[model samples]
Target: MSALRVALADDQALVRAGLRALLERLGIEIALEADDGAALLAQLADTPVDVVLSDIRMPGVDGIHALQALRARGDATPVLLLTTFDDSELLLRAAEAGAQGFLLKDAAPEDLFDAVTRVAAGETLLQPVSTDPVRARFHFRDDRAPVDSFNPREVAILRLLAGGYSNREIARSLFLAEGTVKNYVSVILDKLGTRDRTRAVLKAITLRVI
Candidate 1:
């Protein structure tokens, strides 16, 4: 496979340089580097980058704004958000903005690389409970209908799956073992009559079940 072509967007010069060095050492291509969102946006007009790695709190045009702009223009370049904030609301906003993943800035170097790879591969960043539980909690407010095939626990698990949470995170969020969550995910997929989480979410959205 081609080395992942990446862009580094951050206001701090040193941080950008350090990230570039690390990614380069990993053999990933540094397609572009920018100090802020506006610069990143400018680079995109001429440079075809695969993954955009951005600081969430840059000056002028922030990461969130950049994400919105990218999505608005139908640019599907996967974005990995780097931030110090563990705020759930911010995470929710990032998810809604179509950010592919979230990474704590202080994370170890390998963690950063892993996040980039996972996001580029179309997996969500490490959301502990996925976004499904939150979405289900907020969107699935009414109990007008029930699934005849699934029990309440199954439905609860399925809701998390639909929201896009990973199995490991779902396990921790629900206080279940990792293996249990994996089983739950498999069972949820079978019960929902869908192939995967994204499709399951789409199905729920289509049926108004989530």
Candidate 2:
């Protein structure tokens, strides 16, 4: 198969350089690089790439804005957001804007490469471990719909999932059938308005569900 071409956008030169080196070492082609979101969009208009790796924060036209612009223009390119920390609110916004995945900037090279490949291949990702910090910071609010909306069982399952528990493990811990855990997970995702577990976990943190 031909090497996958990727576009990168980050205000930090060094971050972009580091990502470029890592991607190249993995035999991925760097189709375009931009210092900010608008430039990234402009480059996308002129070049075709398999995936876009963008930093969530930027000086002008951040990753969220860029993603909205792309979606507004009917562009279907997959996007993987990078960040220095697991910002629950920011990542939740990215998901609403159609981001395919979120990864910490300091993530291992293998993690980065795998994320790029998976997103390029049209799969969504949100690491259980990566979302742990936000999960840990979850402060339940009575007024939040998420906190008030999810049942006790859903809440328990979410906590376990954040701890990197598999469905089987969560089932075992909660003393429920695996099928029951799966149903609860699906309900949690629906309530959080996310399609995948990663986004659901991030949204839950943003909504203070845990």
Clashing pairs in 1: 130-165, 132-163
In order of appearance, the predictions have TM-scores of: 0.69, 0.67
Candidate 1, residues 14-93, lDDT tens digits: the string is 99998999999987899999999999998987898879999888889989899899888888899988877455566556
Best by lDDT: 2
Q: Backbone collision count in every prediction?
A: 2, 0
Pairs of colliding residues, candidate 2: none
Number of residue pairs clashing in candidate 2, backbone atoms closer than 3 angstroms, sequence gap of 3 or more or interchain: 0
Q: Give lDDT: candidate 2, residue 150.
A: 84
Task: Give RMSD (Å) of candidate 1 vs. truth.
Answer: 6.4
